[model samples]
Each structure stands twice: as structure tokens, then as C-alpha cells.
Target: MWYVIQTQTGGEEELVGLIGKIISKEYYEECFCMNRECVRKTEKGQEIFLRPLFPAYIFVVTDHPKRLFLQLKRVPRLTRLLSDQEDSFFSVSEEEQIFLENVQNEEHIVQRSLVEVDDEGMIVKAYGPVGRYRNAIVRQRLRKRYVCIEQDFWGKKRKIYLGIRLREDGKG
Candidate 1:
């Protein structure tokens, strides 16, 4: 089962570091604080930096969400588990889970999608993380800066926004 934990927005990295001490690695397969590279234009210049995909939320994939939750509930900076009315354990919709799984590669880095646009500036297709779901793209940001995709998680449909860079000339 997987569970979502709400932690300090800018402190996820530190929270992970703190949790790493008392918990056993066997308790979970992943502790994901997903981030991706983003470019924003400033008066000075275009700045490139990593932005958290799911801010303040850490997703844990484990066979034992309850165990993991209980083990870390009181840990510093971790707020609460995203729970439902019934169970202490809550899982993301399957669709969302699938998307999350696909978002990250082996090193747990979310792929930075590269989009191809025709001379008319329309999105021809997307490469990288969204390569397989080109047709599923809901909105390709103006100038192909990002893409909004629809996904279903735990049966709820969601719109996910991902950053993309336009492909350079002569690049595949």
C-alpha cells in the first residue's frame, strides 16, 4: 500500500533526512519528494531550478503503510497522513499511482519532458516522461513550456501539470 504524508512545504528534504535515522529501509520501497527542473524568466535572466512536483507531500510505496505511518507520525516536520473516513491507510487512485510510477525513472528522477512543436508552434508530440501519453495531454502550455495531463487516481480524475522544454533545432 502507498500513503501520502503532509510535511513542511520547504522542509521535505530535511524531513526525509530526519526520518532516515529511526526507520528501517525494509519498511518502504520509496520516500518520494518529487521535483523537476523548471525555467522562469526574470528581469535578470531566465532562471533554471528544480520545483517540487507535489509540494509538501511525500508519497511512500510500502507493503506496510500503517507501520510506516505509525513509525514516523511523531517525527519532526511530518504533519499527518492523508487519510480517508474509514482507514488509517489511504492509497492514491490506481490511475494516479500509475502516472506517479511512470513519472520517475530508475534513479527516482522525474523525467523532464521535451516537446516538439511545428513551425506553426503547435505541439507535434512530447518526449521524455510524457512520450507514451502524447494523446493524453490535455493542455500544452503556450510555447510548449509545459503540459497538463489528465489522470485517474483511486478513481478520481486529476489534472497534472508537468514542465517541458521546447526541443532545439535538429534535435530528435
Candidate 2:
């Protein structure tokens, strides 16, 4: 099962590293934070960069949640494991996990998708993770090069923006 850990917004990477060192490998299968690819305009040209998909949250795959929780205390960072009102750790739903797994590659990065648009700027086709959820898109920002989709993540609604490379249909 996948569990979430909330920590300081800018300290996710450092905390993940600390948790890895403090916790035994037997307790958890994997620990990581998801990232999304973005295009940034630079003095030379457009550059691609990776940004955190879910800031302040880290996901862990573990069967032994109790052991992992206890071991996590040894890490110096301020962290909290997400849990229900009853205090039981909340695990990612199967549907949510599937969506995440599909969008992210082996490195856990959501790569920029390629989308084809018509002359009127209507999306004709999309290729990549964005394509899978094209119908669910809530907003499209072509100039900024991203499309936003809202999803229920662990009971909370979150709007996620995925980067895109647009091409005119039949032009490229």
C-alpha cells in the first residue's frame, strides 16, 4: 500500500533522503515524490525543468506501516504521516495509485505530453498521460503550455497541471 507523509513544503527531498537512511529497507518498498516536466523560457531558448507534482508530500510503499511510522521518528525533520480521523494511516486508493503509476515514468516524472490542435485551437488528439484524461480537462492554458485537470486525491480535490507540447494538426 502507498502512504503519504507531509512535511515542510520545501524540504520534501531532504526529508525523503533522511527517511531512507533512518528507516530499515525491510520496512518499506519505496519512498519518493512525484515530479512534472515544465518548459521555462531562458535567455538562450526554452528549457525543460522538473518541478514537484505534489509539494510537501512524499509517498511511501510499505506493508508494515506501524514499523515505518515508528522508525520515521528518528529522522530529525518535522514530518507527519497522513491519517484518518481515527488515527489510522490512510493509504492511497487503488484508483488513485493506478492514475499516478500511469502518468509517471520509471523516474516518477510526468513528462510533457504532445497534443495536436486544429486551426481553431481545439485539441484534435493528445499523446501521453494528458491524452488519457483529456476529456476531464478543466482548463487549458496554451500560452503557458499546460492543461489543468481536477482529481479527488485522498478525499481532497486537487487541480493538477501537466505540461504539453502543442502542434497543429497536419502541420507537424
Candidate 3:
């Protein structure tokens, strides 16, 4: 199932990186980390490091949120799950999971990125412009649904959008 955890502000990259290491191979059947790479030039750079498009948030997959929560509690930087109560936790929808799967299966170019599939089997990718722009973004020409990333334009910072493009596929 899917779950949301509170990440320390500006600590999304560290959290997601930790999620990859903590969730093990035996648990591979039970959990996974949803990581997408965004390539941007650094100040002195002529290279690229795969950075998370979603900075302060990450999606992880596990069979039991309770078990996962306890393990995560010990992690130095993690705060809590995104819920009304401090301890209460939640899972993501199955539909969201499927969408993420499709994106991860797509391609990846340097400037472009792909929403990767983490073990939990959820679409945890920062959906909107950035997501859709990833070379790996999925496209179902027949359905006319663009499962890409794009900015929704709601947050104070610039919103990133990712999804498929129906119009571009000549479906419209």
C-alpha cells in the first residue's frame, strides 16, 4: 500500500536516499522507494547528479505502515506522517500506484527525467510539468490520457507538472 511521511524541510533528498537504503531486497516484495531524477547544471559544473524533483517529500512502499513508521521514527531527520494527528498514518490509492508504474517504465535523457517506481507500487512522482517532461513519461495513445508531470500552480513556489500528452499523440 501507499503512505505519506513527513520529511524535514529541505531534507527530501536525504529522506528519499535513506528510503532506498533502508527498504531491503527481502522486503523488495513488500516495499520500494519512488524516486525520480531531475538533471540540472550545478554552479561550477559540466556534469549532472540525479536529484529528486520533489524536494521535501518522498514516497515509500511497504506492506505495513505501522511497521514502517516505527522503523522510520528512529531515522534522524524524518518528522512524521502527513496526517491530522501526529501518529495516524495513511496509504495512497491504487490508481495512483498504476500511474507511477507507467512513468517509471519510460525513457530518461540527461535534461529529462523519469518518475521511477518505488517498491510500494504507487505514483508518488511529483506530478505535473516536470514529471511529464521526463523522457520516461508514459503515453497511452488510444486512451487519450496523458500521464505526465506539469505544474498545478497552487504552491508559493513554482509548481511542476508531469503527465502524458494526449494532444501531442494525435489523439485529439
- Kindly indicate the candidate among 1 and 2 with the higher lDDT: 2
CA lDDT of every candidate = 0.72, 0.88, 0.46
Let me know the TM-score candidate 2 reaches against the reference structure.
0.94
Q: Write the per-residue lDDT of candidate 3 for residues 1-172, one digit (tens) a residue.
A: 6666667556765676676676553332333234443323358732334444445655656666666666766667745655556556665556545545544533221133233334553334533443544443343222322243332221232433233322322322
Query: Least accurate stretch of 10 residues (summed lDDT) in model 1?
Result: 163-172
Error (Å) of candidate 2 at residue 128 is 0.6
Question: What is the C-alpha lDDT profile of model 1 across 43-157, one tens digit per residue?
Answer: 9955667767777877777888777777786576646777876355678767667777788776555656777778887778778777867777888775536787776654476
Off by over 4 Å in 3: 16-49, 106-159, 162-172
Query: What lDDT, from 0 to 1, does candidate 1 have?
Result: 0.72
Which is better, 1 or 3, measured by lDDT? 1
Best candidate according to TM-score? 2
Question: CA shift at 159, candidate 3, in angstroms?
Answer: 4.4
Model 2 error, position 70 (Å): 0.7
From the highest lDDT down, the ranking of the candidates is 2, 1, 3
Global lDDT for candidate 2? 0.88
- Kindly report which residue stretches of model 1 are placed more than 4 angstroms away from their true locations once superposed: 41-47, 169-172
